[model samples]
Target chain A: MNDAPVTAPPRAAALALGDDALVLSHRLGEWAGHAPVLEEEVALANIALDLLGQARILLSLVGDEDELAYLREERAFRNLQLVEQPNGDFAQTIARQLYFSTYQLFLYRQLAAGDSAFTGLAAKAVKEVAYHQDHAAHWTLRLGDGTAESHERMARACGALWRYTGEMFEPVEGLEVDWRALEDSWRESVAGVLERATLTLPDGPRSGAWRAGAGRQGLHTEPFGPMLAEMQHLHRSHPGASW
Target chain B: MSSSTDWPLWEVFVRSRRGLSHTHAGSLHAPDAEMALRNARDLYTRRNEGVSIWVVPSSAITASSPDEKDPFFASAADKPYRHPTFYEIPEGVKHL
Candidate 1:
């Protein structure tokens, strides 16, 4: 007599995706009231909202979204190391966006085409991530080719974030995206953008001890602890209180 | 044109639906037309408020000054015949 869908929702996959969205959303939200320009303030906030929406959906599939987001320990988060990196500068933020959004769009496209628990979310999110990728790409090009200082900053941002790009292609459970193909596509697309932006690619291997990221395994960076404390403080302080 | 950033101001218009005219949403700063359009999308359409957006450089637009309001808009203000209300509705005609 039980008629619920037989597929148990994949907890780990949901946690990973949810954590990625939540972490990146918070990072982007950090730009509120601080973006270099008014238009960019709106742009970054919109992107943050989009990521927050995705995080809410994905997190709810695994557990109480508010609790999961607000109560998780530093090491308990399953986001990629790339997203948890601080928003060092405008150029750095754009570099992170360019890498992450490209991978997200590619992965979401595959998820949207498949039969899975994530299909509906992926279908909706793919369109949003497409715009995110375009926004990042647009900024990357502008910064890379704009002026000497801007170009230098853009180049440094790209190189600094290059290490974290490898983890994006790591396969998650319950999703059927071809990781290798997605990685290849991501590389080609990013390489094309960088070429047009007149920036050089990083020169080191992305998977060795120096470049590998373990945020997928719940390992985060030094900055993550403080960022999480800041994000979760209000919720932890006002438990069960409704806005 | 007045600031150190040198970012130009662009006016934003958003069309909420098909067959409807694009209405003025607001304005924002951008370095160029491409960024202006993207800024318009993010700023004006974040709430699903638009399907299409149009951006125009504020400097490119010419308008009758508010000081000329009497001469520019006064004629239309008193023209009652310009509205369809001047025509009588035939017997059972509705919606007109």
Candidate 2:
């Protein structure tokens, strides 16, 4: 689109980050009307709105936000596999939020500290992501230490999502971040939260034949297709539509 | 979805800005005071509606009974001196 903001190199990084926000926003929005409590429903929706705002800004840097969001094929999306994973259960959703938001907070903090194109957005977004990380961490602590059932569910969710996390540390073109330090900080922060929550960090391989990491390279997992279909359905049904 | 009935109800108080007394915002169910504070932030202050928040367990409050409305409060209605309505002589004062 003519209104696309950045050029090719930064475009990759923007799309990668934007897609993560957009996809995760959609997944979190799925909690509407179904969260365990009214308070939780509001909390999740508020967080989703914040992510949606960030997604809009990030995606706009690449191209027309609507076209990029609604017209992209499933394989074209560059979101992390962890974000595209289904919202299995409440504890599972919290686990996903904990992992992703912690990474996002660290990534944005690093980006904000640099002189990159992402600095402005990252500066503002870091505050929002801090709240998101806190929300996820608090929930993790409560659920992991609450009842036996909750603890088991939280543990299972954490284990199931562990393999997808390594993809987050991979370097993106045009972003000036120390990937190793980012990964180390992310691991330390997440491990601390998990420990305080009384949950163990899953010791599975994060990147290997059995694990996932290709989403940034325009590859996605099985659930991403259906998610994109549902997300894009409305815009595709009515071309050039606006409300 | 887990049952929220097991969680205790908390009364939320929010101070809209500095120097203002915290007023009752609303209530929500949460497992503990910490979660209740967060829930209060989401429920009542998401739109910059507060500068501070306080969450108290609903069970801790001893509320006056509606059935004793006259005995508990109506006796003060006949006393006119208790009302601050006689101090409107100044022009610039507000929120008095």
Candidate 3:
């Protein structure tokens, strides 16, 4: 038995991944009472719970999970801008899930295969993320092909969020991932799903000036501020109070 | 919400473990067979309560009329011989 103390996971990578899970979990939690149907509400809540569990595990690796999650300023969060985007509509939320879950599944699969601090967590999380990806893909297909209104909404949502996807390929300081390969696989996977759903890939610039990125650099979009305020409200109002 | 009313209802069955037959768990609404199965998973199996699931359109199941329950189920009520109550005790055969 190796008795050496385990070193802490790289802070930057943990924060980025943890923040992504935490923020997205909160957004999904927002759908609790508003989902279109009872079954869908339960499904979304289950996915949210899974993500919250993952966020707790990842955040705990860095520092006090509550402090890092509840006390962080908007600019201090390292999550990708894709997750912080508002849940515009059911279609929009599904579109965001399709994009982020695909990226997360692939990233976690890579991490699980390698020797890293994230290996154990990634191994477990990959299974949950796979289901998340499947759920999103199914919704994407149904909404994209169901009816004129649904298809239009789905298309609009996919296009609206296309710009933020490029940031997922940006290399963080600590994670040893092949960004190019990850991005390529992500494009192929997403394109296949969209094609099958009868929706064309959005024709827009994914990166460069005027496109979103830099969330990993502790910079965030406008909506993140309000979201942070809401997430931190109960904790911030009564410090260290527990039920 | 209005659109969900247009969706079909499905009956969910869950098999708690291997070698056991599926038991009717409950019902839920979904757009199709695929979504119904996924929804059933979230509803019935999230607590580790099931190892397998089957979702059938509520329309597909032809349930006996509750109004005719007496006539439909009356045949077996007076037949004690139809049950295997005479079997000897088997210590390890729990489900039987």
Number of the top DockQ candidate: 2
Each prediction's TM-score versus the true structure:
0.91, 0.93, 0.94
- State the displacement of the C-alpha of residue A242, model 1, in Å, after optimal TM-score superposition: 2.4
Q: What does candidate 1's lDDT look like per residue over B18-81, in tens digits?
A: 9999999998888888999998887888778989999998889998899999888898988898
Of the pair 2 and 3, which is ahead by lDDT? Answer: 3
For every candidate, what is the interface RMSD in angstroms? Answer: 4.0, 1.1, 1.7
Model 1 residue A5 lDDT score:
75
Mark the regions of model 3 whose C-alpha exceeds 4 Å error after superposition. Answer: A1-5, B86-96
Error of 3 at A14 (Å): 0.5
Which residue pairs show backbone clashes in model 3?
A: none
Per-model clash counts, in order, read 0, 0, 0
Quote the lDDT for B18 in model 2.
96
DockQ of each: 0.49, 0.73, 0.65
* Tens digit per residue, CA lDDT, model 1, A1-243: 135574755999989998999999999999998888777888898999999999999999988999999988988999999999999989999999999999999999998898788888899999999999999999999999989899999999999989889888888877788999999999999999998999977776797778868998989889999999999999899997786
Candidate 1 chain A least-lDDT 10 residues: A1-10
Q: Alpha carbon lDDT of residue B73, candidate 3?
A: 93
TM-score-based ranking, best first? 3, 2, 1
lDDT of each: 0.90, 0.91, 0.92
What is the C-alpha lDDT profile of model 2 across A116-162, one tens digit per residue? 67887899999999999999999999899988999999999999999
Clashing pairs in 2: none
